[model samples]
Target: MSCEECCQRRGLGGRMIPVPGEVAAGCGLAWKTAPEAREELVAALEADGVPVEAMTVIELLEFR
Candidate 1:
């Protein structure tokens, strides 16, 4: 169960993304998700006892 896998399973507009240059949390990957789902996502991750560096709301332009 990789980080990417967990996010994918949520099906809440989550995707694997590179960690922004300004932040470092041992891993080079970050989870990108919709702002609306942030609270739910945070609760889930925390409940699972996942090691998270930080939760940030990054404004990204979704390209369809």
Candidate 2:
């Protein structure tokens, strides 16, 4: 999605960032944010009538 669309839909202090090649092989963007904020973020998007049919939920493993 475009930055404008993401900015208008996202609730938290999130921004569209370049997708990692390991995540996907294309010139695409994804929203970067803290995992704890998922609920509020989703709620806000729904409240704003943003269609989230294409949204994917992925758990990233933290390397210590």
Candidate 3:
């Protein structure tokens, strides 16, 4: 299953947070849910040569 689907199964609100760079695609997870795996995601992007300046959680009222 896709990451989005997997996250959804875990009851994570769906929202996409920007990755470090355009080199890698972004994700589909709400900031709240995304924050849970923020460290791992940032690490992966950084390791892929993407610029990881910051990794933070933003509370979004809407999914779009």
Candidate 4:
């Protein structure tokens, strides 16, 4: 899936959520190349037996 796709899957977009840094690994990332690397990370984690799930995205545009 694309980076944006993955982010969307995790409920993140132009939104924010209150969570710890440990969950940062699943934030989909803020890199321009995230789409390229994300799938790999997911695959690697899955191969390593790591559980990954999507997170909730909270709209925070108003807070800005």
Tens-place lDDT digits, model 2, residues 3-57: 3365465536766767755667786777766667777767776666665534455
What would the per-residue lDDT of candidate 4 be over residues 1-64, giving only the tens digit for each residue? 3434554555443322344345455344432223345566566545555455653333223345
lDDT (10s digit) by residue, model 1, range 1-64? 3556666666556778778755665558778777788788877777667777777876777788
TM-score of each: 0.69, 0.55, 0.40, 0.32
- Which candidate order results from sorting by TM-score in descending order? 1, 2, 3, 4
Q: Which candidate do you rate higher for lDDT, 1 or 3?
A: 1
By the lDDT metric, which is better: model 1 or model 2? 1
For candidate 4, the TM-score is 0.32
Candidate 4: minimum summed lDDT over ten consecutive residues — where? 26-35
Please list all clashing residue pairs in model 3, or write none if there are none.
15-29, 15-30
For model 1, what is the alpha-carbon lDDT of residue 4?
Answer: 60
RMSD of each: 2.8, 4.6, 8.1, 10.4
lDDT of 3 at 32: 34
For this target, which candidate reaches the highest TM-score against the unseen true structure? Answer: 1
Candidate 2 CA-lDDT value: 0.62
Model 4, position 40, has a per-residue lDDT of 60
What overall lDDT goes with each candidate model?
Answer: 0.71, 0.62, 0.47, 0.43
* Candidate 2 to truth, TM: 0.55
Give the per-residue lDDT of model 3 (tens digit) for 1-55: 2444444545545455544233234753222344577656544444555454444
